[model samples]
Target: MTTKKETRTFNIENLNTRDGGEGESVIGGYAAVFNSPTEIGGGCFTEEIAPGAFSRAIAENSDIRALFNHDWNNVLGRTKSGTLQLSEDERGLKFEVTLPNTSLGRDLKESMQRGDINECSFGFIPTEEHWDYNVEPAKRMILEVDLFEISVVSIPAYEDTEASVIRSKEVNEQVEKRMNLIKKINTTLEAI
Candidate 1:
C-alpha cells in the first residue's frame, strides 16, 4: 500500500530570521505545535499533533529538508548536511535552517524579516494516529509520523478544493465505520 504524505501549515508567531555570524542568515521557528487543534478539510474534521510525534523519526536521524513553500527546487537546508537542525521540545517540533548565501535564501530571509512570511509547514506520513468519532466533527490525534521536510511558507495550500473534498470524504468514511462498530457493541451489551 502506498502511504499518503500529508502537509500541515501553522501560522507561527515566533518565526524569525536572524544573522548567523559572518553575515549569514538563519530562520527558525516551531514547525508543529503540540496539542494545538486545527480544523481540517473545511471543518469536516479537527487534527492535532501529539507530543513526541517526531521523536522516533528524529532519533532515527531522518534526512529531512527545509524548503521554501514545499518546493523541492527551492531547497534551503538539509538535516544531513547540518544546515537544518530539528529538535522536539516541550512546545513542539522546533527547527533552525541556516540560510544559504544564494538568491533564493537571501530573498526568503528578507521576506521573513519583513513579516511577509511567518508561517511554517511540515510534510510527513502518519505512522500512528487515534481518531475520536465521538466528537461532533471528529478529531484525529497524530501520535507518530515519518517526517520528510519542513518549509517556510507564504501561504497555506491545504484547503485547495479537490484535496479538501477528498480528505473530507475519507475522514467521514472512517467516522461512519467506527460509529457502526460502536453501535453494534452497545446493542450486544444491552441484550446480555
Candidate 2:
C-alpha cells in the first residue's frame, strides 16, 4: 500500500550537431547529446543527427548515396533512416530512427519521413564522443532501422550496497504497477 520513489532525476540535454550558429536553418545543424544523468555512467549520451543532416552529410560527405541511388532507382531516400552501422570493434553503433519514434515527435508518424524524421547515431564509447542517450552497447547492431529499446544500469559510486537494494525494490514495484495498469486498461477495453 506504500511506495518509495527513485531519487535519481533524468535531465535530457538536447544539442544541434550541424549548427554553425549562422542563423539560417539552411546552414543546417547536428543534434546530439553532450550530457546525460550521471547515473547513466561516464561518457554516455544520445546522438540525434539533425532531420536532414544525415542525407545532407551523405550528400556533402561523399557520393555514398549515389551508389544506392543507382542501385535502388534513386530511392536513396533518407541517408540515415532505418539505417544502422557499427564500428568493426563493436564498441559503437550508429543508426537512424523515424522521427515519430524519438522523444521529439509528440510521437506522430505523419511528420516522420526520411527527410523530416531524425537521423539518430547512438553510441557507447565510454571515454569518447558522447551525445546524450549514449549508453553501453545493447545487442549486436542490426542492419535495418526499426524501433529500438535499450536498458542500462548505473550504480552511484557513493551508495551503500543496501541503498541499491532498496532502490532496486522501488524499481521493481514501479514496473509491476505499470504492468498492472496496462492489464487493467486491456481488461476495460475487452469489456467494451
Candidate 3:
C-alpha cells in the first residue's frame, strides 16, 4: 500500500530530561486530533488519527526512529531497541524516548532544557482518509496513519498543541496503555 507522509506539530507538553545526564526523557502530547481541520498543503484537512491508527503499524514494526528536525541523516534514537517508547492515548500518540548519552542526544536535551525546542513534529504515512465537501472549502480527514519518525522542531503550525518535557512521572502513561488495550479489543471485536 502507498503511504503518504505527513507531519503534525505539538507544543512541548512535557520534556522529561535535560542535560542528557539521566539517559532518558519522556515526550508526551497529542500528535493529532479528530475533527480538527488545519490547513495543509494548499487545502484544508481534518486529521482523525484515531486510536487504532498506530496499533497495526506499531505491532508490525516497533523499530521507529527518533530524529532531529526530521533529518534522516541524523539518528538520535529508536523504539525497537528500547531507546524509544510509543503509544496512542485519548488525545494522540505519546512518546517516551531514552536519550543517548552521545553528543547529539546531549545537544537535544540542552535545547529542550532551554526551551529552544518546544514543538515536536511527527512524520507518518496516511493509511486511510476521506474527503468532505459539505463545508465551504473542501476538506479531508485522515482516519489512519503509519508513524515513521518523531522529531523536535522549532515552530509548530497548530494551535493549543503542547509538547513539553518534565522530570516527574506522568499519570497519563498508564492511562494511555489501558486505553490502547481497550481500543485494540474493540477493534478486534468489530472485525468479528
In terms of TM-score, the best-performing candidate is 1
Name every residue pair that clashes in candidate 1: none
| Per-residue lDDT of 130 in model 1 | 86
- Give the count of colliding residue pairs in each prediction: 0, 17, 14
Residue by residue across 1-192, what tens digits does model 1's lDDT show? Answer: 116787889987478788999988998989999999998866767899999999999888558899998888999999999999999999999999999999999999888888888998888889999888767677889999999999888897652448756866886677767777877887999999
* TM-scores, each model vs. reference: 0.87, 0.22, 0.68
What does candidate 1 score on TM? 0.87
lDDT of each: 0.86, 0.26, 0.62
Model 2 TM-score on a 0 to 1 scale? 0.22
lDDT of 2 by residue, 41-114 (tens): 12221122122212323333321221110122322123344322211112222222222223332222222222
Q: Which of 1 and 3 is the better model by lDDT?
A: 1
Answer with 1 or 2, whichever has the higher lDDT: 1
- The reply for model 2, stretches above 4 Å from the true place, is 1-90, 93-159
Candidate 3 TM-score versus the reference? 0.68
lDDT of model 3, residue 181: 69
lDDT of 3 by residue, 92-126 (tens): 66676767667877787778777787777788777
Candidate 2 vs candidate 3: the lDDT winner is 3
Supply candidate 1's per-residue lDDT for 142: 93
